[model samples]
Target: MKISILCVGRIKEKYWNDAIDEYSKRLSRYCKLEICQVADEKTPDKAPEALENQIKAKEGARLMAKMDPAALKVALAIDGKKLDSPGLAAGIEKAGLSGISHIQFIIGGSLGLSEEVLRASDKRLSFSDMTFPHQMMRVILLEQIYRAYKITSGEPYHK
Candidate 1:
């Protein structure tokens, strides 16, 4: 299986990059992993709802452009379905069994994903109801995916 993390913006901080690299290395054993980043739109402080929507739309367009048409798209949203590690593992396993060779997980910018992006996704997942920094969320998502793989393989790391 091939897993792609398609997100907005870059991870400028070294610590976040390190965490991502660690997970990427660990995940290499299970499947091919790719991290794709799109340019993020600048948002004014205390911006109005309309302006925020516009920014999200621009970012969403960029994400959609990079999306793989044949891959299963999963969007990360606060209101998305919440799943446990085993459940995620089951979903990933099921996808592979069903002949889904690739899965693309989408992480939006600070303003969140646009309606078009959300509608394009095959699944919407939520780590938590509270909002998280998009950069940090990437790391968290990677770790969960790693855990999911471990769980699927009946490995000891998941505990």
Candidate 2:
């Protein structure tokens, strides 16, 4: 299976990059992994709701442009379904069994995903109700994906 993470903005901090690299290396054994980033729109401090929405829309458009239409799209949202690690593993396994060769996970910018991206997704997942920094979320998502693979394979790492 091929797994791709599509997110807005780049990880500028070295620590975050290191964490991502570690998970990427570990995940290489299970499936092909790709991380694609889109440029983020600048948001003014204390921006109005309308302005925030506009920023999200612009970022969403950039994300959509890079999306693979053929792949299963999963968007990450605070209100999305919450799943345990084993559940995520099962879901991924089922997708592959059903002949899905690729799964693309979308992570939005600080303002969150636009309606267009959310509506286009096959699934929406939430790690927690509390908001997280998008850069940190990338590493967390990678680790969970790795754990999912390990769980699917009945490996000891998942514990």
RMSD of each: 0.7, 0.8
Q: In candidate 1, which residue pairs get closer than 3 Å at backbone N, Cα or C atoms, i.e. clash? A: none
Please give, for residues 1-113, the per-residue lDDT of candidate 2 as tens digits: 99999999998999999999999999999999999999999888999999999999999999999888899999999999999999999999999999999999999999999
TM agreement with the true structure for every prediction: 0.98, 0.98
Instruction: At residue 82, give the lDDT of candidate 1.
Output: 98
Tell me how many residue pairs clash in candidate 2. Answer: 0
Model 2 C-alpha lDDT versus the unseen true structure: 0.95
Q: Count the backbone clashes (under 3 Å) in each candidate.
A: 0, 0
After the best TM-score superposition of candidate 1, give how far the Cα of residue 70 lies from its true spot, in angstroms. Answer: 1.0
User: For candidate 2, what is the TM-score?
Assistant: 0.98
- Model 2, residue 62: distance off in Å is 0.6
Show pairs that collide, candidate 2. none
What lDDT score belongs to each candidate, Candidate 1 first?
0.96, 0.95
Candidate 2 off by > 4 Å: none
Give model 1's TM-score versus the native structure.
Answer: 0.98
